[model samples]
Target: MVLNYIWIGFFVIAFIIALIKVIIGGDTEIFTAIMNSTFDSSKTAFEISLGLTGVLALWLGIMKIGENSGLINALARFLSPVLCRLFPDIPKGHPVLGSIFMNMSAN
Candidate 1:
């Protein structure tokens, strides 16, 4: 995932460089064309990011509601029995179990 982001960064940088080159090396028409293209691309990217952020926020809010409503706690309760059997040395209701459940629920 990190590498994917690095590649996307490289692509954006290359696009900006190309736009700069077009503005510098060409006439007024080329400059306008480049500017318009860049504006459109930026707007599209902004909209997509905004939509994704809204969706993510909604999901997080839903998850928070679930947490507060004890649904997540119920899930943890259901899993705790299996977890206890798997990790026999760990005490029931240990902090580790709670932390693990919290982390899993968050993801």
Candidate 2:
């Protein structure tokens, strides 16, 4: 919710600055530049994602293998004691403790 307001404020400020550039400073290409940048950024993002798809799939496959082989669970159990010490407020056998171990193992 706060992020939505931040994004709106960002675009509003950008529009005001671009309006001043076009109307007061006679910089007619301000809007064109902004449009070009937006399109270019999206295109670049898409290309990067496309290129990384294979790598992402490979890593996910590896994670699945670890999960199937019980390595992830083993790691979770191994780290549970340390996590318990670090997050003593969370009980040792709580679901969140397991989640914390799983999250750490994933990373």
Candidate 3:
């Protein structure tokens, strides 16, 4: 998948940059610094996810309400025409058109 390539690319780029720093600048601590950066980045990502948990739950509840109230279906119907215009190849009144509207409403 694309995510696999992205992870591999990040590692490759980081390794190459660290190698260059060590070879050209004679920075013996480059690897240590690189490892520290990786740890810090992961820690930051975890902290951000933790912070977002409450917001995510709130949004999920709001989405449930919208779905139960028929607001999402109304939105999908309203957007269906626009989506058809944007994706003319999908054909008007197609099942995929409804799905596209649903996806947009969800977002």
* C-alpha positional error of residue 91 in candidate 2 after TM-score superposition, expressed in Å: 8.3
Ranking by lDDT: 2, 3, 1
Models 1 onward score TM values of 0.52, 0.70, 0.60
**Pairs in steric clash, model 2:** none
Residue-level error in angstroms, candidate 1, position 57: 2.6
Candidate 2 residue-wise lDDT at 43: 100
lDDT tens digits by residue: candidate 2, 27-79: 99999999999899999999999989988898879878877787766776678
For candidate 2, report its TM-score.
0.70
Q: Candidate 1: worst 10 consecutive residues by lDDT?
A: 26-35
Ranking by TM-score: 2, 3, 1
The top-ranked prediction according to lDDT is 2
Q: In model 3, which residue pairs have backbone atoms overlapping below 3 Å?
A: none
For model 3, give the 10-residue run with minimal summed lDDT.
93-102
Poorly placed runs, candidate 2 (over 4 Å):
87-99
Clashes of 1: 0
